[model samples]
Target: MLLCGLAAVVSACGEPAPRKTGGTGTARPGDRVTAASAVPVNGGVLVDLPGNAQLLVVQPRPGEFRAFNPSCPHVGSLVNPPAGGVITCPLHGSTFDPASGAVRKGPAASGLAEVAITLSGEDLVLA
Candidate 1:
C-alpha cells in the first residue's frame, strides 16, 4: 500500500499547471495570444508575453489584425489600448495610429514597434 500511495503522489505532482486565460500570462512564439473574438474591430487588447514583454493586438477592420510592441518609442512607457481609434501613452501624452502604429501626436518622436501575429483557426498566434 505504501507503493500505491507514493505512485499517486508522483502522478499528482507531474500534472501540468492550469493555463491562465484572458490577457495576462506568459506566452512564447507560436503560442496563442487570444481568441480572435477578444479583440474588437477598430480597437485593441494588451497581451502579456514571456520575459515581461507586452503585445498590443489590434483590429482595424473586420478580419484584419495587427500587433505592436505597445512600448512608447519616446520613453518605453506602456501605451493604452486603442480608444476612439487612437493609442495613447499615458506618461507623455503621445498618441499613435491604431491601424498603422504611426506617431499621431508627441512627445514621442517615433511610432510603436510592430510585432508579428497570425490568425490560426479561431485564435491569434504569435508569429
Candidate 2:
C-alpha cells in the first residue's frame, strides 16, 4: 500500500503533455495583452497564446516586463511559476530565473527560451 501511494504521488508530479513547436520562441505579432489582465506578482502569470504556446511574464522591476517560454528544456515539462521569484520545474527539480530566463539549477542545462514583447497603450504586444 505504501508503494502504491508513492507511485501515485510520483505520477501526479510527472512530466507535462508534449507541446507543439510551431511558435515556441515567439508570440503572435500584434497580439495585445492587457497589463491588468496579467497582474504581475511572485512567479508571474501564465499566458496562453495562440498555437498552444505558453508564456511566463514576470515584472521583476516596476514597469519592466520579461517574457519566456515556461517549458522545461530537460524533458518538455511545463515549469511552474515562481514561488518567491524562483521558477521551478515540478517534475524533475529544474530551476530557472523568472527575470532573465537563465538557468539557475539543473536537470535543465539550458535556460528558458525568451519571447519578445513590447509595451503599447497599457498593453503588451508581441514583438
Candidate 3:
C-alpha cells in the first residue's frame, strides 16, 4: 500500500494532464513579467520555456494574462490561442478559457498549462 501510494503521487507530480499549452514554466500566484518598458506594443513579447519550448503574448486580462504555446497538449500537436479570448486545441478540438485554462470540452480533462504572465503597466508580459 505504501509503495502504491508513493507511485501515484510521483506520477501526478511530473505534470498534470496536458492542457492546450502548459508543460513548462507556469505562472503561479505572485509572479510578474518584466521588459524594457518602452518597446513597441505591436511586437508584444516572448518567453522561453524548458525543452525548446516558447510562448507568445497575445492578449491581456488585467490581473491575469493569456499565452499560447506553439504546441498542442492533446496529441503532441500545436495549439492555437483563444479566439475572442478562448484557447482551443487544434488537434482535438478542446477549448479552454485563457483566464483559467480549464477544459471546455470532451477528450480533454485537463486545463491548459499556464505560461508565465504579468501586466506591466497596461502591457501583457509573455513571461
Ranking by lDDT: 1, 2, 3
Summarize candidate 1's per-residue lDDT along 9-97 as a digit string, tens digits.
Answer: 99988868554222223666789888999999999988876655668899999999999888788988889999998999999899999
- In the range 1-127, model 2's lDDT, one tens digit per residue, is 9999999999999898766431333445788644634746544777766667667777776778877777789988888777877988999999998878899999899999888888877887777
User: Global CA lDDT of candidate 1, please?
Assistant: 0.85
Clashes of each: 0, 1, 3
Q: Which predicted model would earn the best lDDT?
A: 1
Off by over 4 Å in 1: 1-27
Clash pairs of candidate 1? Answer: none
lDDT against the true structure, each candidate: 0.85, 0.76, 0.54
Off by over 4 Å in 2: 1-27, 34-37
- Better model by lDDT: candidate 2 vs candidate 3: 2
Candidate of highest TM-score: 1
Higher-TM-score candidate of 1 and 2: 1
* Per-residue C-alpha lDDT of model 3 across residues 1-127, encoded as one tens digit per residue: 9999999999888866443433345543443444434222223234554444456444444333455554545665655645665556677787765555677874776765666555666554544
Model 3 residue 57 CA deviation in Å: 3.8
